[model samples]
Target: MAQTATTGTTVAEVMAELAALEDPRIREVNVRHGDDHGVNLTKLRAVAKRLKTQHELARELWATGDTAARLLALLVCRPKAFERDELDTMLRDARTPKVHDWLVGYVVKKSPHAEALRVAWFADPDPVVASAGWALTTDRVARSPEGLDLPGLLDVIEAQMKDAPDRLQWAMNHCLAQIGIEHAEHRARALEIGERLEVLKDYPTPPGCTSPFAPAWITEMVSRQHTP
Candidate 1:
């Protein structure tokens, strides 16, 4: 087991801890998800718990460009403190899936710049950036759907999702499922689109895990919502 940070919280010490925690097996698993880190997330979060929030330290750790260290930095940084453009730059630099996921889920989602960035990245030439935009859109679909063009979103998914790169395809599939589960008005069309496109239809889902195939995912979630 790697030692938890009980003493030093400086970049050098935290990075040393991260390097010490690396496991070849963990890296092997993470590589499948487009990540390159090996530190267990539970231990990383434990380290963050000891260090608490140190936004400046977070920046320095992120500057190191180490995957585990950036993951740690995300845990310790204040989300709302980042400028919009700074977040954009970080997203552009975050090429790995885990780092990109954490940046979007932990920081960008909480930042006031979320919507602006969502709109900006939605049509980005980079599929990875567009995937983040779709991820943000999925959040909005579930939480606040007031002014979003549900039909237009469905149209876009119907048109582009099948041919999108892996990450963007997954994100679009999520948005499709969210629309189907949350809005009864769009449920039928969402399911219909999913069935017609056949995206992720053959994906191997682990036991008791819902398929990322959109129609099945939508049906399972919607069923759970109505479960007694």
Candidate 2:
């Protein structure tokens, strides 16, 4: 493990460290996720651990135009420092699904403006923005369902989920699962929507993994929550 940098590090220094930690096999795996820099996640984490948290450094690193560095930026960024327009810029710069997912899941979801962004992005014309919106909504539903318009959310899913873009559909399906598992009052309605949409019905599930298909996923999650 690299020694933790006691002082602020520059983007150049972080890039140098990342270069030193590059591994071909790990890069191949990253490639599958649309990261071509071939930097291993373990190596990135090791470096990020050493770098600690430096919001300014994170922005500089993200500006260096490398996929792995951008990912590390998400790990170290100060979510509060990100204003709405900056986040919008970041979303525009997120050229691939992997980066988009990380920015939304790890960074945006933690921002103070998450709720506003979620509602706005869910309705955005851009698929990526809309996907992130739904993704954030899923997180909100799972973590803090208070004050959320659950019935309205379900109505949107019921009406538009079938025609939603692929990524949006996945997030919508996840939102349905979260509702079914966490909100007993809405579980039956969620299950009904799942049956009607039949989302991910034919999607393959890995052996020993629960299917993301809403009905099965809801049933499994509910069963686990009730167990013991």
Candidate 3:
């Protein structure tokens, strides 16, 4: 394990550890999802465990422009320490799916600016950014859907999901599945929209994995909720 300062560890040391941990097979698998890293997430989290919480170190690691490092940064960084605009800039720079997803899931989702960033990113013209927005919206759909317009979300998904880009379409499909699973009032309509759009219906899910297809995903999850 690398020695660390009280405030943080050196980026060089962390980068060295990451380099040693890289595996070609992992990188090959990650490339399918548009990520370029080879460091397994379980190993990466182990590194973060050694480094502990280090906001400044996280920033430095993120600045190194390495995918594995950025993933590590998301793990060790203090989420609430970031300013909203800083988080927005980070999102723009996170072009890879793993980094972007981790940033949103591990950082932005915990920030005070989550809702504000969600609104801004949702309307951005960039599909990748918009996907982040929808990702946040999906979280809200599952956890904090008090004021969200369920019908309106269904309307946009119905209107654009079929033609949306891959990432955006996936995000939209996830939100649709979430709405169907979480809100009984809209479950039938959610199923209807999913059936009509057929987004991700043929996605190649691994054995024992739930399909990303909205109708199947929603049905499976909702069934589990009702299981004894």
Candidate 2 segments exceeding 4 Å error: 1-8
lDDT tens digits, residue span 1-228, model 1: 223244445678788889999999999999898899998999899999989888888898899998999999999999999999999999999999989999999999999999999999999999999999999999999999889999999999999999999999999999999999999999999999999999999999999999999999999999998999
In the range 21-128, model 2's lDDT, one tens digit per residue, is 888887787778666877767777777787777887888878887888898998888888899988988987897777888899888888888888887888888876
lDDT of 2: 0.85
Record all residue pairs in model 1 with backbone atoms less than 3 Å apart, i.e. clashing. Answer: none
Candidate 1 residue runs with Cα over 4 Å from true position: 1-8
Model 3, 31-115: lDDT tens per residue? 9979999998988899889878988888988999999999999999999999999999999999999899999999999999999
Candidate 3, residue 66: the lDDT equals 98
Residue 214 Cα positional deviation in candidate 2, in Å, after optimal superposition: 0.8
TM-score of each: 0.95, 0.89, 0.96
CA lDDT of each prediction against the hidden true structure = 0.93, 0.85, 0.93
Residue 215 displacement (Å), model 2: 0.6
Candidate 3 CA-lDDT value: 0.93
